[model samples]
Target chain A: MSQPSHSSVLPQTELTRHRRLREQGSFRRADLDAILDAGFVCHLGVIVEGRPLVVPTVYGRDERVLYVHGSVASRSMAGGTPVCVTVTQVDGLVLARSVFEHGVNYRSAVIHGTVRKVTDPDEKLEGLRRLTEHATPGQWSYARQPNRKELAATTLLALSLEEASVKIRTGAPDDGDGPDADLGVWAGTLPLTATWGAPEPDPLLPPDIPVPAHIARREGTRHG
Target chain B: MSQPSHSSVLPQTELTRHRRLREQGSFRRADLDAILDAGFVCHLGVIVEGRPLVVPTVYGRDERVLYVHGSVASRSMAGGTPVCVTVTQVDGLVLARSVFEHGVNYRSAVIHGTVRKVTDPDEKLEGLRRLTEHATPGQWSYARQPNRKELAATTLLALSLEEASVKIRTGAPDDGDGPDADLGVWAGTLPLTATWGAPEPDPLLPPDIPVPAHIARREGTRHG
Candidate 1:
């Protein structure tokens, strides 16, 4: 299937449209970009041998494509497969009076496309570069670049960001105004925060080397 | 597919078998239990029409079955569909000297089974209770229980935990003994920690209501 949307807002397709909970859906392309940027790891779902397989893998994205790499033999890394890449940032739990009304405060984006195996040497380099920089910025230049053999063993799959769905749920529980409010059960949100901790130096590292500024700055920072 | 394994280790079914990175795979059933217990949210993958769809949803599990609830109308909530439920907890980013060796320290469990819809009301209530308690302990007792109407609108799917593949990656990168270690670029792990923050009371909550002790206890505690 071809996705050819040029509008600023993501064009709705049968795959990207929200059939239920329409209010939680977003048509804005920027919202999709933000959700993708907030997390480096994503759950990639693909059909393997007539069965659905979901794997967690680190990813990087450019203006229009999401790049993920894995070992060449992995099921999710197969080229030309229709893949659903989902990135979710769970912000908190909405503790409502009723268990039925409870919800999770989160930002999630699902992108659907036929993954194209990156083959061009220059494009593959760029994709791998984006993948490294996406997870740990400035480390691309600091780390040794992938040599030809390393690149060959790695499979980088690129999926277009053209067809995507973005959903962000924030704030209080949905049962605040409902009849359950009279139950007097304590209800609110317990926010969840992901933070980067201090860098643990590799045991084999020589003592003379210090944590780089870029890596050091990430400590204690919000991850998603 | 019939999964009738009685051993402490998960049976190596065609679906659960690991093709690559054989060293990272774990066959122990207890390992799968630990991975599932570490996280409440899971990425549920199912084939809709013909393409793959991955959704992030809250989940709970018991000794034999894993439970997840969603709106009855969701594509991922369909009954008797072959599904892949994957739960992953990212511990840290493994930064190595070469970009090619970069990896994620994570614990993940992937289960494949045909989902069974809860038609019995008693099992439905128990499943919902387990789900609520999974995300927030003591929540089911503190919150208002689900009524008939709410239960009808919800769909609970049960997948057997018997067929699962567990993989846990910990410690430093694998390139320490490789040639890239001579590059002199600092390499180690930047740990990721998920913690519960101070509860944000709902704006509509009565001022006299205090935060529940169970909820308060989670604050400043490690999650996943």
Candidate 2:
């Protein structure tokens, strides 16, 4: 709950300002990193042909840059346009005594900036590595790296994490002391948690091929 | 999976066209219902002051309309704005032998339309009920409903489900027969499942009050 250290804190800009629920907003760099590291999937929001399109995609972060990839033909992945990348993790559902006060306990980070395609071969390959490893740790070294032709078919865009907004909500409902507290209704939070279940091998795989240790260790472990 | 019944299929529009990955797209109305019923949270995408913003909020669906509410002071909740609401449920992580083939198993729906404020009192009340029960089943009748002042302070906007795009991805990775299959590396899916843990009562609650039956029943149950 403490603010991130000053040196690592993100600078507050016009776009990063918390207009609502200011108490739940955090400007700490550590807080931003924690939220980003906790989840690999993010919704990329961009203006496509004068319309707002939000597409879910996998992402990775290296320092202050966030990388997202999609098919080269994807209109949303085209570079030079401003984008909003959002990563949200719902921790629990807040059930109050009255429907008016209901809310969710979640941690969300939204990054607003212009994205540029990574054309340099080295950075593109490195960006792809970070993305793969971000979703599945140890998979980068374990799997066959993408070849030149494959990389050419993919579009990688990088956005700066400088202008980002982070919001985290926790604890009980806000109506505990309100007028509805006397309603005699049971009210609290129902925590939501996701875990990695056992790996389901491909039906065509050889029966003797056992699951790798890195993948096997994640079974029953919490995700995000 | 087979398509939903003909009577319930969503009509495809220019906006809902499956421009990419046509194989994973569906026009089945039942597919949209299943995706919405499984989760109550959605990301609201809209153009605010010329910039696209994506906000996470709770939602409820009644037939052909989706209802989302926020405080009247919320900038993102204003009416008369064109919006795109997206709901995504991540089922699993597809681990492939090559980074190029890595993907996720998920079901997602993207809704595009202009939002209108709910002015009718009856429909507003019904919409609130759907929102409450959608998050916690049976809670609408269990708890005290919203009062006059509470309802006045809330902004309820309705968006038609007519223009929606559905995409579902399941099963194994597509690189089984590709060049990377001979690398002897592990390739499969790590299923991700979320469940509701035991409800944690408020600290100030009296110990004599037992958890409601409807709430207790959700414990250890799968969440979308």
Candidate 3:
């Protein structure tokens, strides 16, 4: 028998195994990267005082690591903590004939890792820059970079991308051939899209300054 | 001294307490309701085998309960499990003159509660109806409802909405008067909006079937 393809496949460990709906799970490393690249915001889950706490945080990722930033005073940004970060993008609604077959067309990636707080000055700055540029491309050079004092007050957590799971569902819903098909109810997919709108200048900003090329061009562009 | 308004405010519990970013926290019951109503998807954080697991799932909420459904075999949907569910809607990006001052304008709600599995057939059906309708109004009535066997294969977890926290950030970015303001780089808010696009009928659907009023009317309407 030919050897199973492992060149570009993500390693499946106990944490990354798909326990349910295995059909939706993807083992390709490219799938994980695509899911992470499509969104800049992720919900971070960490155990706080023996209970789970989910926080909505902004994130940026490189090929090897996912970077999340927060205020130094934030409780969840501590280093060496095991955390789960999930980024989800809703593509549309799967309008099946039956409620049981109805589902969401979405792409999501879940990452499991221990976060390491960046204390080194250079990596911290670079991590922060990636975080900024991830959310708004071309933003790092456009905005003022963080200074020592400003950087001191911020915490950057770097999570490895090795342990990750990707699940994507698209197209029409199930039940077209199922028993519910006899019901004759309408069935289809309703596409949902997030777009960036025109930039509203800061009220205090001087009118002479025009919207930047990077920011202005993003109008009507897809986000998440 | 006059008593602080307590009638409309959510009870402050240890889990709902906002330790950091006090300015973004809200105790108002109406705020929590509004945030929950604005989105149908939530990130559910649950402790699985001593490690935090975050899953992106669809959710629906009533005044006192938030319902989440999944296959009965799903591990995180087990009853008596303590879970944290967070719903977030990104409104805009705050482009500050300084990277340190940059932020996201968003509204989010975090809920902490023990999930109760719905066993009563009536309540289970009702919960499923709410879940369907939450994602698509009039969907429950228009689509074929679940039968007895289908309900048996599904799990519905009901979470109490009594303990929750709300945070909303809007408007222009900070740094208007900060040292970075003098840098003269442009700063503003780029609004992000999610809208429903035209429905695409299932390829297997009969050509005579037209998009229903309930689904077609939502085209071009703002979602989250």
> Ten consecutive residues with minimal summed lDDT in candidate 2 chain B?
B70-79
The DockQ scores of all candidates, in the order shown, are: 0.79, 0.69, 0.75
- Compute the lDDT for candidate 3: 0.86
lDDT per residue (tens digit) for residues B29-91 in model 2: 889999999998888787766677887888998877899875312465456678888899999
Worst 10 residues of 3 chain A by lDDT: A1-10
Model 3 clash pairs?
Answer: none
Among these predicted structures, which one has the highest lDDT? Answer: 1
Evaluated against the true structure, the overall lDDT of model 1 is: 0.88
How do all the candidates rank in terms of TM-score, highest first? Answer: 1, 3, 2
Q: Is candidate 1 or candidate 3 better by lDDT?
A: 1
What are the runs in model 2 whose C-alpha is more than 4 Å off?
A1-6, A71-73, A76-78, B1-7, B71-78
List TM-score per model, in order. Answer: 0.96, 0.95, 0.95
lDDT of 2: 0.84
Clashing pairs in 1: none
